[model samples]
Target: MLALPAAPAAAGDIRATVRDRDGKPVADAVVVAVPSGGATGAGIPPGLAEEDQRNKEFVPYVLPVQAGTRVHFPNNDNIRHHVYSFSPAKTFELPLYSGTPTSPVLFEKPGVVILGCNIHDWMVGYIYVSESPHFAKTGADGKATLGGLPGGDYTLRVWHPRLEGSEQATARPLAVPATGAVDAATTIGLTPDFRARRAPTPGRGGY
Candidate 1:
């Protein structure tokens, strides 16, 4: 997808951390920053927005994309997969296939889209569609730094797949500096994963 070419004035960065209620780092959590005034997608470039099926699961597990970007779903495994998402933000299905699809799916709205494979119940991934281009997903250490944001007032929030409450409840105001980096953080409450409790074993998985 294409991005606007406008550049931000006095660009800065947002260094953030995601922690659980017990003060433990949280992974796969998406952090979003909505500008108080200005186009969120302007002056930002789109990154690799692909979700690949490999080793019977979705790689990366979590993807953060700016609104209006088209995302690719590629099957890198020997077997085919029917990837689909019935989410309200963007709902569509891809027929069973391998390699890459002929075209990518456009995510026009801002919201969380849960992806699944019709042939594999254990295959679950998430696409965090953000209205603003200023976003990033927490890594193993639950740390993510979003750079190139201009100095301004913004509403910051974090989203997790198993978050106990809504993303809106985690919202807070933030002031980004004109240069260098600033710190922001959030503590979340999570719910149990809905997947089966057993560990991966041989032969019972999708072929």
Candidate 2:
């Protein structure tokens, strides 16, 4: 029998754990991996993402997306919300209306975009726009997996809503193999989340 050509090596997964300075599992922490050789902006799919406004809060709390992602801010509450971001990465507003705006906001820059609501001062969210597509968010257990990344050297970094220092301060070099999974761990200092603590609308029971 004739020999068939060898298949290209498959991409792998990068699993990471994030812990606070006190060794507590840090949830909603985003870990991003940028290619060390400066080849990025291709692995990530450019499309749609959502940062929902529900229960007087931004649903995901922390969202990680690649640059060029169009994120929809859908307000599902009975009350209208004025969603806006004053961050240098993205600054825009959806003037007081509910039920998914007609035009989604595009995230064209790579940085930390802090989201907030004018009407509800307690409402807050975060969007981490990564330069590379290889990234993941830590779960309640502080574990996150960046899957399907081709083997290569990467500059790994972590970001959190209340991180104490600049995101760049957590940078570390990583070497990913062409196959199988890699494990990484990072410890960071987090500042207390000082978001306004407003009482939920009488019996509404919200965050």
Candidate 3:
């Protein structure tokens, strides 16, 4: 019998804790790993198609995809969803969809792309496509561990739907030692509201 090869050890890990100005752990925070060279050798796991429907909502409120990944939209509700965004990451829309679309949505860049259902007005979702495979989403405990990072310099950034500015403006630098652990902590300010709601009743339309 042939012996199996050993799995390669991860070069390093980035353990992090996120908190707000008040020191309370922030939930739904997105942490991104970007190498300085603007290149990556990691392949993303297969992604499933998602839907944002006329029930005035997105099926999955938060999505994490690797850069250059494709996402699909299948309208599953009786109503329609007009998904669009002004975010620099990727700006697109599926005016109103039903069943599987002809093509999936592609995210070429690494950043947070905020989604909105123009028709519903109050529906929103966030798509966070990471540049590095060594990333994880924070759980309710507000902790995330990014393992298998190449031992080198990385520009790490945290993002949230309500984040105040550009992710690049808030990124921090860290060096992942070849064989040790590093704890990184950062605080971010958030906007007052992060909830979805129904649009106000339209006023009497002109005859």
Candidate 4:
């Protein structure tokens, strides 16, 4: 019988935990792991992303998508919504509509996109277009796991809506091990959230 070599170990997973300056778990934060020296493999495949409007607010509040992904803005409320974003990453608008738009918006650039409702000034949301494919959003527990990452040097960073400083300041170098998982934690300072307060009902338009 011929002997065969054992299969190489699978890529390791990265588990990240985020907290605020006050030591409180932070939710909806975007965590990204970028190759320290640029990525060599094929980029993640493009896919459909969504930001839904319900109860006069953008669901999920924060969204992370790979560059070149198309995002759909679906209205689930009884009233129509006018969605727009003036961010440098992607600028687009969807004039008053009550349901899914005829077409989706393409985010070809890598940057932060701030979303708002022209009909509901209090409604705000974000879409983070990441240049790297390795990214995940923290859930209510303030934890996110990115799996199957080949061992290598990487720059790990986190982003939140109220983050006080530049996202670059949060970048931390990490060396992922070949075999098990890496556990990482980050604490972020936050500025006072000055988003417009939501009224009991849609009172006026213009954010």
Candidate 5:
């Protein structure tokens, strides 16, 4: 009989906090830590085949998964929905459907994926599949810590939906020791009017 192997221990940790010019915490900011050497395939992530459905909207609004992971979209609403995205990470669509699709949508690369429903124009969602395992999304207080990072050189980057400039512009190199804390920070100017509005009622006449 064969025995399963033990899981690898976390080598290090990355404790990060993001704040604006006024020193106030910014919530829902995504922080990604990409390995400099471009060596992926470390360990298996916790979740896969995540569900993004039309409950009159995208469930998570923002999803972060490992590269090569599959995502599922099930139409939970009564009406059918056509989901598609123009993001470079992955570009595909599911024609109007009521139940779960037979095959899962796979994200082959590492980048942010923006989703929208063709039938319902107001539906919007994001999928961020990272190449590196060391990454985390900031909480309401703008604090995120990525533990279990192997000690090495890495390029850490920050991304937001409301960001105006390039994602590469906000990137900075990070060096994590075998066992210690490192502080990384950044401030980005966001678009002035950026907010999500409720979708219009289907078949509602124009004013």
Candidate 6:
């Protein structure tokens, strides 16, 4: 009987650069890597992620979490907020409230979840339910690093709130080295951001 070679261990890291059509760095863009053979969503232990409501806005604006993660919508503002989402990924509502709900919402599917406040039409937020545990959000420098990834074949995808077209259209095949690091970059065309701008309010805090 013939025995197959042992599978290579996961090593190295992936640094991804994301830019807009005109070559400007894009912040808050979600980058995900789905292994070809199949990825166990990041081995992320069951936990809670918070999407706080402050100053009539959803803090963090964009959040990326592994599927099966639960999210808390805590209202820190003086005013009550009614948060809801029509996104196919997770559809639910939080009636007008002033504080955190007793329970968190579980997002079990892999897709984009758009959040909005019924009281404030201008208030909008996004929760990206990642199918793979290997995901990162680009920072102000337009770079996101996925470290300690096992070297293998992967489908890399980039998604932005204002991404012009379908998120799937931005996917590309990637081959990670068994050691060291790999650099990858992608340019995404984005439509104009139509989110409403509100005056800065005091007591604003991070998510």
Q: State each model's C-alpha RMSD to the native.
A: 5.2, 3.1, 4.0, 3.0, 4.1, 5.6
By the TM-score metric, which is better: model 3 or model 6? 6
Q: Write the per-residue lDDT of candidate 3 for residues 49-123, one digit (tens) a residue.
A: 464453557767777777778888766666545678888999897776556678889887977888886666677
Candidate 2 backbone collisions, by pair: none
The sequence of per-residue lDDT tens digits that candidate 1 reaches over residues 1-207 is 899898756888999999999999999999998888646745565545788889888887998898888888989998888999999999999988888998999888989999988778788989999888889899989999988887888999999999999999999999989898899979999998897442454674555
lDDT of 4 by residue, 31-146 (tens): 99998777733446879999999888998799899998998899998888899998988999899888899899999999999999877889999999999888899998899997
Expressed as tens digits, the lDDT of each residue in 1-207 for candidate 6 is 999999766676889999998899999999998888775534556568999998788998999998889999999988788899989999999998888999999999999999998677778999999888888999999999987677788889999999989998998999878788889999999998888776443553321
Question: Per-residue alpha-carbon lDDT of model 2 for 145-206, expressed as tens digits?
Answer: 99888888888999998888898899999988889999999999999778899755554333
Q: Give the TM-score of candidate 2.
A: 0.91
Report how far residue 76 has shifted in candidate 3, in Å. Answer: 3.1
User: Model 3 misses residue 30 by how many Å?
Assistant: 1.2
Error of 1 at 160 (Å): 0.6
Q: Each prediction's Cα lDDT score? A: 0.87, 0.88, 0.74, 0.88, 0.77, 0.88
Clashes of each: 0, 0, 0, 0, 0, 2
Clashing pairs in 1: none
Question: Which ranking of candidates, highest TM-score first?
Answer: 2, 4, 1, 6, 5, 3
Worst 10 residues of 5 by lDDT: 198-207
Point out the higher-scoring one by TM-score: 5 or 6: 6
Cα TM-score per model: 0.88, 0.91, 0.78, 0.91, 0.83, 0.88
Pairs of colliding residues, candidate 5: none
Q: For model 6, what is the error of residue 196's alpha carbon versus the real structure, in angstroms, after optimal superposition?
A: 3.5
Summarize candidate 5's per-residue lDDT along 1-207 as a digit string, tens digits. Answer: 889898666477788887766787776678888778777535567356565675678877777788888888887777777888888889898887777898889987989999987777668888888887777888888788977777888888877777659878988899977677777877866666444576676684320
- What stretches of model 2 exceed 4 Å from their correct place? 1-8, 200-207
The residue ranges of model 1 lying beyond 4 angstroms of the native Cα positions read 1-9, 37-41, 45-48, 197-206
TM-score quality measure for candidate 3: 0.78
Q: Give lDDT for model 2.
A: 0.88
